[model samples]
Target: MFSFSDQNGFCGRRCVWVNGPVIVGAGPSGLAVSACLKEQGIPFVVIERSDCIASLWQKRTYDRLKLHLPKKFCQLPKLEFPEEYPEYPSKKQFIAYLENYAQKFDIKPQFNECVQSAKYDDACHLWRVITVSTNGSTQSETEYICQMLVVASGENAEGVVPEIDGLKDFTGEVIHAKDYKSGEKYAGKKVLVVGCGNSGMELSLDLSNHNAKPSMVVRSSVHVLPREIMGKSTFDLATMLMKWLPLWLVDNILLILTWFILGDTQKYGIKRPSLGPLTLKNHHGKTPVLDIGTLERIRSGDIDVVGGIKRFNHTSVELVNGETLDIDSVVLATGYSSNVPYWLQETEFFAKNGFPKTPFPNGWKGKCGLYASGFTRRGLAGASADAIKISQDIAKVWKKELNHKKQKVPSHRRCISTF
Candidate 1:
């Protein structure tokens, strides 16, 4: 039990007994935390905003999308993907795996319940969570109190739409990458894909396969590398290279190596921009189309690479070089922004980009128990790192609470006494 005193008197103090912790978001990070907590026999409730687990994977990913990392490295801890699955699981297979994981652990999250806000109550030393759920005709808001809060909401919650001038006025359909699932919807349409990221590249390929006649809008030069370099996974190769060299040196070396392996993309109207991997700052490192059968399609004049969209009208899109393209729809794969709205307004503990500040010392010491995971840039291995760190911290806090409870026993009541 914990109590916080008010200025009125001892009678004004509010006491809250520890029940269990609350985990917000049911993504990979949240599921990992829930598994760890369940293993420890710690009571917890996981809240998800969607109707199903791994909804983002099912809803937001485009067709032909595959895991950037190998299957061996991308799976949750203690759960191995079956050998029947491919080297890189597809969106549908990944979602099925998550379903199996949840079912195996008996982790049934309360879905369709979205968290609106959470605030710490000093008087009770607990976090009060407010959630909204739709109930047929009317909506209802429910509240829950917990001793701690774990925010596992991923960084890509809010889709980013590039602020293009006069975009709204264009009559053609405009869609973000989140709304794009398959190229089937774009059959026989003239599609202009904006951005040169993985989503843009893969979506263009899928569209071309569906006879959509898609054109890619390249803003700047992009570095294209094969998904596997020298018969190994790209991630594995990058890890090995980075281990022995500085980041800059490693990036330069990889760039040179890729250029030698894959001829200059300039012949296809694509230029090599970065020397290394595509990063937040350097968005130019394009993954090699992985020879996933897309190369032959490109060589057949199915996919056309064009300059960036300088401006657009109802029926025509003008390129940066004054070239014009008449398209039926625009698919913007501009990426996502890191925004956690619920707690950002009330807490000063967050990054400039709105992610929660990590390595919370006081919260750890006092057992206040607020922590963030999966916001760091460890690529596909980020979720794993977050799980390890969060589990260690939770264990420390749980031990401290148990010790405090044991200390409350009277000396005479001890079963075994030490003289």
Candidate 2:
């Protein structure tokens, strides 16, 4: 129950009862859904915390970044990358595509409105999304009451920074991979890059190209696959093989191919997981790092692949292997996590990690008209799939209500999916 007399509580805030769903992100996933909904002739309000769409790409990513996968796998719905664009579009090209997509769909997100809390109001049977916006000294709060809610804020809303022993003791600069743009500033410095995911590998490669000596930390085992095999995308090849073979067989084929192409990566301190690449990805969401010139650099000794760090000294890191290396700076390519748990005030749909409790293929829909998009670890392709499903589900219910009710306005909770 909410208090009607309270000054700063539910009743006091400016409330807008939305005619349709409220999408909580403006990234590719959100834009995809927006386009799908547009096709369905259903209106939605996209609420974005950042001033611009795809803020992660525009603000956080490195300058040398390119789509690790082929452009065909990374595009949004209703539009494809330009024909002249390369197979793996650059960071700028991808961003341009997203911007064009949003414009084509007329997806105008409410920029800078940070969602503080979103909860299902039992009394009214609607989702109450409370948001706060600030401009100069003035701050305003708005409560958006909608029939359906779409959580498209994505999995990488916040960067992860691990706490290292004696990290503060280091006198040199420390930065997360999100802040890293280029290696131009580290031309001659010895930099230690933590984590061996795509960002870590790319950062190390970039640093090496700029004449910086970089030691990349491989704390644990990770599967690394060549971006392409025999002029075909490694991922595309895997997908095709999976159609005709069992997962284990597909994994073996991939391993055999990778061996022939890149050799045994364990020799360079990078170990493969016990499960196959696709198997690991399906079960545990562990994505294999798709090599993009980083492996050659590693082979050439331009980038040093190292073991985990034991601790940080004033100007060096003590490795778990008992080796010590002096470094001028530290770049933590520690990855990112979802920010849903911070705002969404519900328990059943979203897990504590801010992902749907149900795994992908079934994670999109939840009780009380909650839906998730782009939470799938499968990247843009998964997001596009989710967007289509969500739009179809919502549109079906909405149209049914309109047809049945005739004169009555399609009431709240009408878009609830039977699934």
Candidate 3:
């Protein structure tokens, strides 16, 4: 069912025709969908901009990074983590699991193919995906034509680097959290860590552990919850409670427990948001920080917590509170956003921010056989659910159409690639 594209002429442009779908990512979301479609006896070709699978995990993540949530909730569909893996698998462990998943499912993505544009042809009734790839000094382009197109590039495809006043003037090491690997290089130096999300918190902790002084910026209010409650995971507890109790009640209970365990985080320059953690996340997509030893480090005076930045000097940072501190490096953990809007031509299904106009549980499907897999802010569990739904829905339609087409079903789909 999978073969090289026909050598026929299309003005010398390479083209690939897919009978099933062209999945536009090789990350967990796309992998999950591909695995499910394979189970349904569907054919698909994954296209990844990066060469390796899960490039974020393999290349961008820090050395000490581990899953913020437990492994059970993070696993993809049709496969479970190995029993030997810890509750929170490290970055390497997670990457290993993804590799094994890809191997098991036989999901071979066309790596290094970055989609330039994807648009639907109204008259032809097919999705056209134009991709550009570079190999050494040589570059190539490919166009894929398919009935169904699965947009699985995900939310964190690109990093967000904010415009900071005097950032260009600062004469010190500046890096985004994506390129940061370890604090080994910053040992015995003062480092300014921007953003207070999970990455910022964990990165600051790692800096302190490596003997580097880290001052994290907490500009706005954030909900910092204990990673565990007594012996149970806070995430697990909340999920369990939400099944039977209301979300508000569950939020309140978790907050109370967090206060009891972590004490008044506000006293340490950290402010909790007005809305409850779950409510804020649901409404505004602001995820509460799950404290993983960062609070303890802060309390112990190991990791300093600072306020917003007014500007940066040659060797000092001016804070909104009129305070200033000298630092040797800066790590902007400003987070990431989706690149869907940049390449996706349609506007109705996806908003200007690149997320679906419809939210999770309903955002997976769209008109003209278009689908999205990981726009869900709910993480792996939500994505896994979407993957199953997308596969099943596509299967139903594909089967019906095939039955109607009868003997006209083509055995080979075209693909365009030239060495």
Which number leads on lDDT?
3
Task: Give per-residue lDDT, candidate 3, residue 276.
Answer: 94
Order of models, best TM-score first: 3, 2, 1
Per-residue lDDT of candidate 3, residues 1-419 (tens digit): 23344487544457778888999999999999999999888998899999999887888889999998999999999999999999999888999999999999999999999999999999999999988886678677788989999999988999999999999999999999999999999899999999999999999999999999999999999999999998899999998999999989998999999989999999999999989999999888889999889999999999999999999999999999999999999999999999999999999999999999997669999999999998889888888988999999999998999777755645443122121
| TM-scores, each model vs. reference | 0.85, 0.94, 0.95
lDDT (Cα) of model 1: 0.71
Q: Name the candidate, 1 or 3, with the larger lDDT value.
A: 3
lDDT against the true structure, each candidate: 0.71, 0.91, 0.92
Clashing pairs in 3: 5-415, 15-416, 16-414, 16-415, 17-414
lDDT of 2 by residue, 135-250 (tens): 56877788888989999999999999999999999999999999999999999999999999999999999999999999999999999999999999999999898888999999
In candidate 3 the C-alpha lDDT for residue 344 amounts to 93
Off by over 4 Å in 2: 1-12, 407-419
| Candidates ranked, most accurate by lDDT first | 3, 2, 1
| Distance from true location, Cα of 62 in model 3, Å | 0.5
* lDDT, model 1, position 167: 78
> Highest TM-score among the candidates is held by which one?
3
User: What TM-score does candidate 2 get on C-alpha atoms?
Assistant: 0.94
Q: Candidate 2, after superposition: displacement of residue 313 in Å? A: 1.7
